[model samples]
Target: AYIAAPEKTAQAISTMSPSLITFKLEGDHLNRLNIPVIRRCLEKATAVVVGPGLGLHKETEEALKEVLRIVEEKGIPVLLDADGLKAFANFKRRLRVPLVLTPHAGEYKILTGDTLPGKLKDRIEMVRRAAQELNAVILLKSNVDVISDGVRVKLNFTGNPGMTVGGTGDVLSGIVGAFLAQGADPFNAAVAGAFINGAAGDFVKAEKGYHMLPTDLLEWIPRVIDDPMSHVKVRRSVPRGL
Candidate 1:
C-alpha cells in the first residue's frame, strides 16, 4: 500500500524499489480496494494464492470472493490458505477450475460448522467429506497431513513439530503456488508441497533442532524438491479410498 493513492486508484506501478513481494491493500486498513492492478497481474498468472496476509476487512473479503469469481469464470488455478480461508469461512461452492484449500483445525471447524473426529480414519473421512461438499481439493494441516479431492486421499508424515514456527505455512503456500503455476494439478501440488515443507523442517531440525525459523526451511527447499524422497527416512503406505 502506497498510502497516498486515491480510493478509486486501481493501477499498480512496478519499480525497482527492491521488494521481495508486494501485497495489494487499500482503505484506512483492509477496506474497499480497486483491484485493477490485481486484474493485470492475473493476466500473466497461471496460478494465484490468496489470503497469506490478506486482512480481515470486508473489502478484503469481498476482494477474495471477487478474485475467486474471476478465477472460476476464467479457469485460473487457485490456492486459498491462511487468511484467505478465514475470509471464506462457512462458504462452499463447486468450481470447475483447479482449487485447493489448505486449512488447519480451527479454520476447518469454521468452514464446516462441525468438528473433526479424534480418530485418524474418521479425521481423514471428514476432510474428504469437506472436499466433496465444496467440490474442491482440501489439504488439512495436522501432525500428519491429510489431503483429499473427494474421492482420492493421501497422507503426509514428513514434518516435525519444529514447523510450529511462524511463516512456515506461508512458505508452504508459496511452494504449492509455484507448482500450480507450473501446471501441476492441485492435489499433486499440495502433496508435493506438504512433503517438501515438512522435509525442510526435518532437515532444519537436524541442524538447528526445534529452534527453527521459516527461513531455515527455505534454505532446504531446493534440496528437498530436487529429490523429495531422498530426504525421507521412512515412507508409510498412503491409505486408499475412504
Candidate 2:
C-alpha cells in the first residue's frame, strides 16, 4: 500500500529481468492505502506475498491486516515474511485462507515468544509446535531450514554461509511465493521452496563464495527446481551450514 518508492523501485525491478511482472503505485505513505487500491491488485493475484521491504509503521500494520481480511474472504494463499510476520504477530483473528510463514530464529521468537532451543531436534519440535498453534506452514530459516505444517515436517540442508547476505531472504520469499502461485499446497510449496532456495545458494557459494548476491542465486533457482536432486552431491559434500 505505502511503498517508500514506486518509481525508483519499479525502475529497479524493470532492470532486474523480463517477464509479465508489473507493479502499481499506491502513493508513498501508508495512509494512501485507505483509498483501497490493494483490492484491485488482489483481484488478479494468484498468490500474495507480504513484507519484504514493508516498513514497520503502525499504518503498515493496519494495512497488512486489511490485506489479510481481503485474502481471507477470497480464500487466496498468502505468505507472510519479514514485516508481514511482525504485523501479524499481534493479529488475533482466525483466518481461513491458506497461510504460510517464513521466519528466521529472531523473527520466530518474536512471533511465538519462544526462545528457540540450541539443539536441532529440539528446535524442529518447537517449530512444529508453533505450526500447530498458528495453523500455518512455518518455514524456519537456519543452518538447516525446518518446515512444518502441523502434521508433516521437512528439513532442508542445502545452503551455506554465503546466503547471509542482504536480499537473500527476499529471494527465498519470492521463490516460495512463486510455488504458491503455481497452486502448490502450503506444505509442499514450502518444502520445495526451502530446498530450492538453499540449493541455489549452495550453487552460488561454489562459484562466488560468501560474496554471492541475491541476484547471483536467482539464475540457479530454475536450474535447482528443474533437477532438485542434482544438488544431492553438494548437499552431501558440504557439512551443515558450511
What are the clashing pairs of model 2? Answer: none
**How much does each candidate deviate from the true structure in C-alpha RMSD?**
5.4, 2.5
lDDT tens digits, residue span 1-242, model 2: 22223545656766656763545555553444543667777887888888888778887787777778888888899899998898789774446978899999889988998988899899989999889888899999999899999889999877888788878888888888888988999899999888888899888877777788898998899898789888987666554553
Residue 110's lDDT within candidate 2 is: 80
Cα TM-score per model: 0.85, 0.91
What are the lDDT figures for the candidates, one per model? 0.76, 0.81
Off by over 4 Å in 1: 1-25, 28-32, 233-242
RMSD of 1: 5.4
Q: Residue 38 error for model 2, in Å?
A: 1.1
